[model samples]
Target chain A: MGIPIYPVHLEDPKLQGFYDGLAAGELRITADTETGEWVWYPPEIVTGRPDATLEWRTVAPIGSAYTFTTVVRSLLPGDHKAEVPFTVVLFEPDEAPGVRIPGVLVDADGIEPACGMRLRLKPVRAGDHIIAGFAPAQ
Target chain B: MKAGGVAITGVGETPFIRGSDDTVLQMIARAGLDAIADAGLTPADIDGFVVNQYTGHGSDELAHVLGTGERRFAAVADSAGGTATTGHALMLAQLAIEAGLATHVLVPYAIRSTKPGGVYAFHANEPHKAAFEMPVGFFAQPTYFASMANRYAHEFGMTEEELAAVPMTYRAWAALTPGAQKREPMDLDTYRRSPMISTPLRVADCCLTTDGGGAYVVSAVERARDMPHPVVAVQGIGLAFNNWPHGVLFTQKPCTFEFPGEASAQRAYAMAQVGPDDLDLAQIYDGFSISALVQTEMLGLCERGQGPRFYAAGHGMPGGRMPINTSGGHMSGGYVPGINLLIEGVRQLRGQEGQRQVPDGGNSHATTILARN
Candidate 1:
């Protein structure tokens, strides 16, 4: 059996920028004006009040695993066979507040994920495709 | 506050079923008609409509199917796994009534159970769907909640059996509710032996997808006083949003049943001028067992990390201190797009819920507090 695969098209310019930055080895942080709070994945506006402000800033790509799960089910289309028993995680950036990103966990076996596990990002090139995953701290 | 006061005058619900051949419009129309009739009103009395986003049907189409004309307020809200729509609709109705834009409002939702698959794929298109959060499989609402449950279990030395008890207890409650989907009772052994859909969450731990509809008629308090049923005033309501950034996830303390849900509950309680003890019954959204446990703590029914013990003590059952989810909740009551939870709370308060009626003889005009995440 092959690993299930799917593609997500990026739409939001800010989100596209974030993903593009991740693919290019950088991190971006932005503050929501409506809620007067900072957020990741670049929210449109802070939710409550209109006229919300948003400012983007670049930051280092250092974070840790807040929580994770080993997925036994497939949510994609095709089977890759190379990736089975994959792990998905919610990674919390070190310098940001209430900022967490979700990505795959590489080489995650034999080690259980906790609420605050120190993790670092590793970019992998899978056949011309660059993807990010969490690895145990060096 | 001449802004407008909304009161629930009529409520209607379809028998919770595993699946129905009826279209989403049919379900909505059925529930709407029943609700209108219950209110002793007609389609012409309704001038506004509110519905859930992606409810497998359109609100405009539903209004058309019900032969509603000249809708002053028509909206579809997307609260992202949170049951904010109940309060959202209430606020909308209040505004419409206050603005003299509409005297009567209909809040309805319908779900088709034939599609067993979740709607995570479709939700990706939502504007607020976080980009970084998309890559991970946290797409499903249950998964995010399951992670919390997993953390709760790990930190507090909680057991799957303890987690399983919440749903098992609800299943028992549903057994008495004729309109519930899973009316059959299950023992602790059976609940614990169920297949695990997610760690710390068995198949029985989650709510069942079902074909159903829930509708309510809201009007100004003065107008509602003349209706058939006694008016259930919207004493107070509040909504809160927590949009923390990515790093907060790691440094933030695990929710341990105490922190996250409290803010919303406090706002709601203060607005209602009622405490947890004042509630006659509660219809907390129980998308999952652990979610219900967290809600129990958040609603101030019990202390943080004391949910399992409170539940074990039979405090959540009927005749107990807090008779919660009297309509079996989403877990056993049949998942009716989460809106049914609101209607059930009203039903319990109105003493219309037979068999599963609360201990107060279902008479004393009671106050119901509904919390959703």
Candidate 2:
């Protein structure tokens, strides 16, 4: 509890489903009910049109690493020191278009990741919070 | 004539130093008082105002302490990053003058980046930071920009020395600047040897988190004629928001390295009635060294994918084909938000930068860029 960091308040009404999905080991995102567009990072409403509703859709738990960085230094205080030199990646799911999400590349240290390398989602618990991450596809 | 009837009459700033003794209020107030005095006006004459976020007690506290009359126009600018803060502050002040809301307007920006909690303060505050970004270990701005720099280098085959030139030029310029924080002369060797903050971003490539504040007085063109210093005209201005998804994450793009400033720059140039060729110098925001390169390209200063080559060819240096970040920019000048760059633009236009002055003492026209990532 060095910095008192907390995960997304799944307790909130708007984001309850996203957190519940993570807790349940299901990866969910939103798609336009009208335009058939997949939205990553789970938008509350369809982009650009407030009147349109975004429907929750369960997505494949696998993606490809689009781009990433190897953090050699720790910028944050506390338990982050042990996490130095970890890899953070922006990944594109196989099902989404123009939508990418970010997460730590679990167990990716010493691994030279090439673009389009397949990665699968893994949700782990930190303190009382559940965080999403990715591991190289076996 | 982008937004007419406005001219920057005076620019002032407290020393750009790391771990300064001044409090946030003191830093901003000192700069504001100096600017108002430089404009040859008093607090009472300042009818309009805008300031970057310091805390809740911003506009009213400052106005009261300055002993000003009825506050005709006073508001705080926040949420947007540094560049947008500067642009919106200026635009709001411009609108105040043009719409007869106020005769003279004041815009002030200050940051205590060197404070123990300064850099990470936004983590808990930005609505999305605490939950989505910080929990995943994306704790600071540098890592976010570093990803783009890495991708850009990989895609374009930009050599390490070419990337090194970005900070190298700024450090050289900063040496000439008296109060600049990192003014020591830096050669390619020093930059190459600097510690890596993140992959593809060395320590020198990131902006110094120093404490400082800057303020500017904007007056009608008629009032500018009667002022003491040469007029730094607000010739043109433009602003663009993160229209794409995920804001700074920029997940909407097939290539994540691109900056979204093309539309903003085009709009500003259109309003100014000048193209990139007509610009004498640019003070584009350099929160990260690579951002300046991307912004210069997006602003049409050079062709896309030519930024690395442009700097490597000895452009953007003093007396080079293109003059950029002449006052060391945020890298050396201290991140006084983006207002310090605006101050540098005014100083260059007025032929006031002593050693770092561009050739021709700044041509007949000048443009200072404030771009958000």
Candidate 3:
């Protein structure tokens, strides 16, 4: 399976921290500044706390696959024919319980991907940018 | 009855076709006219309208298109997707009729899947999706649902054959349905032969793409007796939202496959003063095999995690104890969302669906349950 290659269009500048975290070789997630509680996918208003500010903090890369799927057909906006049959997994950080970060599973030659399978963060460079990637942790 | 009762008096739909030259408005106009006529009423009789927000049309627009006079009530079903078409639209219509805001209310919805940008365009516009999920190639409905199917199988136990049974069950119904988009016979082997879009989810496992429109009229149950068809009362309808926004829906739910429909089912059953066992048949919005089966469990049709096995046991098929989607659901019939399923329910109550009609138990009553996330 080839690496998925697609442009990351960040409409909200707040999300740039995620990609920045990746560039710095770390898995970062958003949390409310006051409570320091994890809020995933980075919603604009932070639920009920309009006054709360979002802060990105690097968490332990070791986690387990919450759920995953192998995309035999690429449904990205443009043609991604070369990136067929890639498994996209929702990974839960060891520190965060409900927070899930979506990424493509990597470096599992014979290890079958399943829910709760141990994995570690391994950022992968597709075309021009790096995206979240998880490799099986033995 | 209650609140003078609001029953679905008339239903109409354009043919389920792969592609149509007609604009969305044109299809709505045609279907609207047919539904009014089916109700044994003229355009002048319809004074209230409940329109879908996705259709991008207003009540004033429908009035202009249908040539209706003196519009008294107009509201939009903001509940997006199939829920808007089936659940929310019906609730709005019932509210309008009960409030005496309008007499005859029309609910219309149409989908042009082949339109430019296609259906995924809406998702693409989601800023969170663009920045986070899309870059990883985890976009598209099939991919999203496929992931859920895999996780559901792991947690709840679903075999390959069990998953195939969902669409296969619906296809059998489609074979008997005249205007169904796909009516071909599909056995287990045939299902195996179908191309896989994502693992465990073949093309057959997903909802069909078609350009079609369906409309229904709702009026007081007392007035429905004067109409053309049997009075299929809106016995009970309960709509529930888990409160997950579109951006976080796929990834953030406590259980990724959870739709939170059990609450809705309980409310519906209470309102109708009936339970799951009391229904003669049911019509579920089958957008994908996974979500359909999950909702089936939520509706208490079978034990939790037994939706796939329910079909594998042939319970949802023809001559089964509990028939579901008497008309081919979205998977086989056509993907005009929930409106077609609503039309099919009304048709079955009228006992007009020749070969596919569920056998009546004297007076026909079907409890339709559908949910979307």
Candidate 4:
């Protein structure tokens, strides 16, 4: 099934790095440059420390599924009826222990998606752009 | 605040309908009037107000519509969902009443879920969700809770039957609740037949799409002695947050399945000088079965990770030892966020809910309470 088509708002400067990394075929997430701690979804300002700066750095593409759901109904705003029955996985990269990246599962012929299931980043094309998709790892 | 310092003197709600022409403001006005009248007072008698921000109606707007008297104390519940309308609003109302800032505070909330945009529209428009989640088709409460259900089952070992028990328990009570929205009988087979929205989360597992409103009048417990209802006083209340804003709540939490209900529950139980065993009944916020399940454990209704088993064994069903969501809850009752559940709690405590009321409701004292997250 095709992924649901919704415009990724690249207008937010913090989120632009994720899509930019997707274009380069690498998995990158935001982290504090000074502390080197992962701050996910790239908050405009760190929780308490407003002065802390965030930087996008590439990490290991291979990861394990933290949690997943096989969406039988598309909750997207528009008509995404044809995009039913897609499994969305929150993949935790090997490098980022607690951080999870949302992606659609792909290239699993007979593999079942479960927590702690091994997966690797596999970007796939949607309607007009590519999204972070993952395949079962060896 | 001290126990029995303030009490819910009156409660009212509009009929929970699917396609009602009532706007949010209209519904609240009607419900607010009903509550005011129930307290044997006109709108002009109400002085304090606790208005919910989610209603998109300000204190000035509510005052104007209801024609209430001078508002000595008026505050807004700035949080969202049940946390704002139920937990935070009550805390604020009691604080004001105890501080002598005001008495006769009206806290009202209503929802037009069937509005121009459906219930899921709000989630679709979130900036972080639009950026990170929607692209992968991960949007809406069902999809988000569905993911949490999977993680919960994996950790705690939940069977499909165990999960089905959650909705089944609530529907059993709804059958006796004449005012409940979906009162048709629902068994295990019927639950299985409910269409699946996401893995494990069927339509039965989600809260109903309700267009209705509910409001309650809070007054000093001493003032409620002359009011028309039994004193369902504010014995204990608690609310805690980990800075988990709506944006990162679904995805970035260390353990997304775990809501911070325990911390709040512990604090509330302490304040009341009571334990979970002391509760005669409870009304947990049932936004989703997975959420209700975890909350059931957090509220100490059952052992942690045994919520499914607790319900499957008929612990929360009618006449069970621990009666929960006595008015069918949001799942099968009405979804006015926490307001309806609060109304139901008051009704049950008042012993006016014909057949749905719990037997010997409480200890003739102050052991009963509603625990929210």
Give the number of the best model, judged by DockQ: 3
- How well does model 4 score by local distance difference test? 0.86
Model 4 misplacement above 4 A? B363-373
lDDT agreement with native, every candidate: 0.66, 0.72, 0.84, 0.86
Q: Model 2: per-residue lDDT, tens digit, B28-65?
A: 78888889988998888888888666534477888876
Query: After superposing candidate 3, which stretches have Cα over 4 Å from the reference?
Result: B1-4, B361-373
Which parts of model 1 are misplaced by more than 4 Å?
A: A1-5, A12-39, A42-63, A75-84, A93-98, A123-130, B1-6, B51-63, B68-84, B98-100, B113-117, B126-136, B152-157, B221-226, B243-261, B361-373
- Estimate, for each residue in B1-373, the C-alpha lDDT of model 4 and write its tens digit: 8866888888889999888998999999999999998888889889999998878899999999999999999999898778777778888899998898888999988999999878877776568888889889988899999999999988999999999998999999889998899999999899999999999899999999999999999898889888877787777777877788888899999999887788878878877777888887888889999899899999888899999899989998998988888889999998989888778877777788888878766521112253210
lDDT of 4 by residue, A70-127 (tens): 8888878778888777889999999999898999999875777899999999998888
lDDT of 1 by residue, A51-136 (tens): 66676666666777666655554333334335545566667778774566666776656777666777777654444444456676
- Compute the lDDT of residue B332 as modeled in candidate 1: 91
* Model 4 chain B worst lDDT window (10 residues): B364-373
- Candidate 1, residue B152: lDDT: 74
Candidate 3 docking band: high
Q: Give the docking tier of candidate 4.
A: medium
TM-score ranking from best candidate downward: 3, 4, 2, 1
Q: How accurate is candidate 1 locally (lDDT)?
A: 0.66
lDDT of 3 by residue, B205-256 (tens): 9999889999999898878887877777776777788888888789888888
